[model samples]
Target: MVYTAPGSAAFSRKRGSMADKITAELALIDTELAAVELGDIELNSGEILVGNAGNVATAVTPSGDVTVSNAGVTTIGAKKVGKAMLVSESEAVAGNIFVSTGADSAIDEVAVSGDATLAASGALTIADSVLDGSNVANTSPDNVIGAIPVLYRIAVEDASANNDITSTHKFLVTDFWFVGGATPGVAEDTVQLLNGTNAISEAVAKTTDANCLVRATQLNQSTGMIAAGGTIRITSVKNTNVAGTAYVMGIRVA
Candidate 1:
């Protein structure tokens, strides 16, 4: 072509055509933008439009595991767990729970009318028991004879004439046993067992070997040997006659 000035008829006509093309393109862009702004875009279910950091929304179709984050208060009617599972803060009331075998393991409420039997493969530990034969099996809640509670064990070398043995706590003496030094088979030592001022078992012969004397005859019977906070004073007839260490073991029931 040929060069022409800006005010020329040919130049003005070409410039007008270019301006028309630009105006038409801009109008088409405006129409498309209006459609988008009106939310005219359609999507299938589960498809979503995500916004970027620039706040521009782009259509995205997620596959595999779609993470739902920052959603508050999700509720489910029922959930099934397969294989091993862990959960926190589970609670069970006084109701029956059944495994696949249909056996019911029920927890009853606190006892008001009758006794409740607790049976389990594990131990049933009772912190406090008001248990009795009516509630517990093979339970002698009142019997203390079967229980051996050692109140005090006194050891002395050649106990003096008025050797006194004191106990911190009072106990009901079931039986008193003493091991003293003596010639085997030679009964030479004699000891008196006294409860405070009274002699419970007097002239009790102790040999070189072990001597177990049951003071059932001397016991108060209504109460055991001695009341709580009571003491027993053991006296030796001849201190030099008793050769070895005199160990006095007192057995009692709590």
Candidate 2:
């Protein structure tokens, strides 16, 4: 209420009677705002004092939290804050949650289906390396190429007799072999090669002397043998005086 400025000064009312009627209505509105213009002066609220400033450019309504302490650079445009929690107990650097372009980066490239469990206490680092199963290729039917563990080669031949050696005969040697004719003892034939079928390896014999060859070697493994299963028998013998023919081959190894 005491603002004088026009035609010089002197509106200083030191005492009070409501400070001399607000110093004569502020010296008649400072002689009409001193002929206006000072950027046309506008004060729409309670406090406005520019010159020796105490900066307070606030326009707060329903919007609250806006704190800038040791300010160096704090620029906020459409500042709207309701719940924005940023807490740090000890180490808080830069504080970044800046993700620029659209829809949260396509929802972070989603593709999560089955099992992904990592209950770690510490060390877990997977960079880049590949070596799946090393080398694995297996075909069915009588497969016995050195048994099984990390197999190398297996192709037990059957040509067309198609008995197919009951598929690669993996270790089941039941000890029984005899196929003799032509004077080695007139006639002797008994072949059961292996029994106790679980993964198969059974054999018997019948020949019309297409070259007569049937022999069984030490073929061993008892007390429940299975490192992949085990058995081996390969024989060949031919002597024709009238009847002679036999062929048997069984080999298993793991």
Go through the candidates in order and give each one's C-alpha lDDT.
0.47, 0.35
Off by over 4 Å in 2: 1-9, 12-103, 106-116, 120-254
Candidate 1 clashing pairs? 170-229, 182-208
Total residue pair clashes for candidate 2: 13
| Model 1 TM-score, all chains together | 0.35
lDDT (Cα, tens digit) per residue for candidate 2, span 19-84: 676777677888777767745665443333444344655432221243332333343445453223
Model 2 accuracy (lDDT, Cα): 0.35
> TM-score of each candidate?
0.35, 0.19
- Measured by TM-score, the strongest candidate is 1
lDDT of 2 at 202: 29
Tens digit per residue, CA lDDT, model 1, 113-165 = 22333333333445455642123222132675454445344543454466665
For candidate 2, what is the TM-score? Answer: 0.19
